[model samples]
Target: MLSPSLPRPLQPRANEVLPARLALSAAAAAEGIQLLTRDFAPWLAERGRANEFRVDRIPFADLDGWSFDEESGNLAHRSGRFFSVEGLHVTEEGQPYGDGPYADWHQPIIKQPEVGILGILVKEFDGVPHFLMQAKMEPGNPNLLQLSPTVQATRSNYTKVHRGADVKYIEYFVGPRRGRVIADVLQSEHGSWFYRKSNRNMVVEATGDVPLREDFCWLTLGQINELLHRDNLVNMDSRTVLSCLPHPDAGAGALLSDVQLRSWVTGERARHDVRVERVPLAGIPRWKHGESTIEHEDGRYFKVVAVSVRAGNREVTGWTQPLFEPVGLGVTAFLTREFEGVPHVLVHARVEGGFVDTIELGPTVQYTPDNYAHLGEQGRPLFLDTVLRARGDRVRYEAVHSEEGGRFLNAESRYLIVEADEADAPQDPPPGYAWVTPAQLTSLVQHGHYVNVQGRTLLACLNATAVKGA
Candidate 1:
């Protein structure tokens, strides 16, 4: 073997340089080198027309290379790769926050333990940071195309399990020649739909010349921020990766200190007891497998269905897979209130059955109104009405965004940021709720499993829109 050489410096030259650069990028609102801000939507539409994309719902028997196992009744690929649809039984105990002392539910969950990469490549253009983004097509998306990250790929796709074309710009995230890692953390997905699912949310700074593809463009963070205000433009993966970017500590002060916030979250997790187990999908209760879909008896929650997808630009030109389609639109919002002139958002420590951890910080209101229609007015979630009835003047930001299109079909949530008063949401809120500054939430997002996927998306909205409480 050759003689060993000295390693490079363990610490970077500038300890806090990346955050400052990111702040500069966040402040830059103009269009970047390759794409104009106004043309982004039109360009995405053009890309949609360039491909032969089709998604037709089919029965379980028509799925190609995919089938339900005769033994377990789990819907999976024949190769035993990618993800599988399995049944989950969850029981919550010990002072559950919303419902009662105890609660339980049975649902189908997507189980994909393999960690995927959701990365955004950053390269400076003329002293300003510009991010590499892709116009990707997902069959389950309402529009079938959205602004995605530079590289969004599962282990099976990146590892060539599908025997398809290479994932573009993946080397910058994984290989030996990978760029300088600015931010990298494992972030959770929709805990309600997925079972302990997490992806590697990464942002890397490219040091060398990078080639551009037809479907990819370089955008400043501010441009992305402007685009975020639009409906279903920026995809969920891009938003989550953007949330991991470091923010400056410019807040005047927060109601809760960072240590207090962490302690509160930990307390929330410790007080709740949640037990979950995987069961065969063959005999899950309250669900029936029909010819076209597996649906709930009451027509609430979501259903699992199969689709045949054909796209020209994807790694694999054509494929068939299953998607979880929610029954109704969801409303996910954060109620913001000013404390000592500092803006703080109400964060609810929510417990979902599929979370690896017992609980994660969710938005002030995250629910599908239709699912709770049976409960009537008294049973409606707290602050949900405040979000729904807020006038235009009190609404700081509002947009309709889709969930992970790769797994969800038309799963749209009306995301909002509404101003609230002490009368609406008190200073000393009820248990399982706390007011934290956006910067504090951003700090927690740097680590894994602290905030849920919906929380991250709202945090990204605050970061992008720079919304300040009046």
Candidate 2:
């Protein structure tokens, strides 16, 4: 059996090759064609070029094998030629083995489209130096690993012999979104089993020094895929499950086994497991900012009339090491609901399609029996309308009085201030304070009135009247 010697210290500093292999990313993949599989090719087309995971052929030399399914019996007929792997991680000894020559090897967790788990079995044959890796894929894919276990087979060669190398073997398992994962065994039990692994967190490192040992079997991404296959027509929701690719290129190999399987939709990876918890947003404080009622964190002053919430995940956009990371959070609110007025609410402002903050919407003019529909509702329309009336934008208006107690909100006369979008709008410039001009002072004494525009004088007009001029 292969025994890997590990470093005493887990942390490896700067640009070291040891940490590089631990980095299961689009760029660092070099060991297996696991990245080149058809499912992964297109997913990382842009990323492969960016990261250089693309290669002419798949990595890892393929070993002959056989496959079995509990429901279908022997998939490989008499020759259960199992697909095995060579030159992969050996965790028999312990962690911190001398840095392996090719540092790209990683144990990826893959989920087929319709099935519960298409687990990759990371194992070593009895006293053998080679590593055995297996995966289950859709039948249509061109390259198929024939030596696979029977579907729902209890004796399907499944077991987690060792947890000793988890820190080292799996290093860091990360993904773009959320999904449920469980550990299973090939047993006679009727139902499948699951054990939570991790949530959608970006991996700082994906590979590590896998200690080799006879007792502990290596858990490869492919082997996990096989153990999860279901025999009957089962449905799965892909929205909640995360399928990991070894390299960006390896994304090509993944495929959903059954078309009808369903999975739950999830938001960005909140916890370590794929099963998303329903957070009670009841009375959860609405999005707030500094003293303003913003619909969201951004304090734009739009009235929020509606808000929608849902959950899902993003695929790999190239990252530093592990390419997957949870991008955004999910909402418990849904757009469509059978029941009227869903308890979970979002502020949909009376604004355009994009996010409109509730703060921008003026105070609800809840004048009962009189909908303020006449004012052409816009954000802070009361203020805007007042500006229009004061600056002679309107021909007529009802003069109203203001209360001494009202700070800014006045019922009788609502005084509003508005800034123009452009320069063409008329404005009553703020009352200017100035000393009387020498010419205007003399005119004021001569006549009782004075024209205010640009300091024009009524004194000249009155003087003309006194002189008998028209």
Tens digits of per-residue lDDT, candidate 1, 87-159, equal 9999886555673322878889999999999999999888788999999999889998899999999999999
lDDT of 2 by residue, 196-273 (tens): 111121112213233442222222223222222211101111101111211111111112111110110011111112
Candidate 1 Cα errors over 4 Å, as ranges:
1-15, 99-102, 250-252, 467-470
Candidate 1, position 340, lDDT: 91
Per-prediction TM-score, please? 0.95, 0.16
The per-model lDDT (C-alpha) reads 0.88, 0.19
Best by TM-score: 1
The stretch of ten residues in a row with the least summed lDDT in candidate 2 is: 187-196
Query: Residue 50 error for model 2, in Å?
Result: 36
Count steric clashes of candidate 2: 94
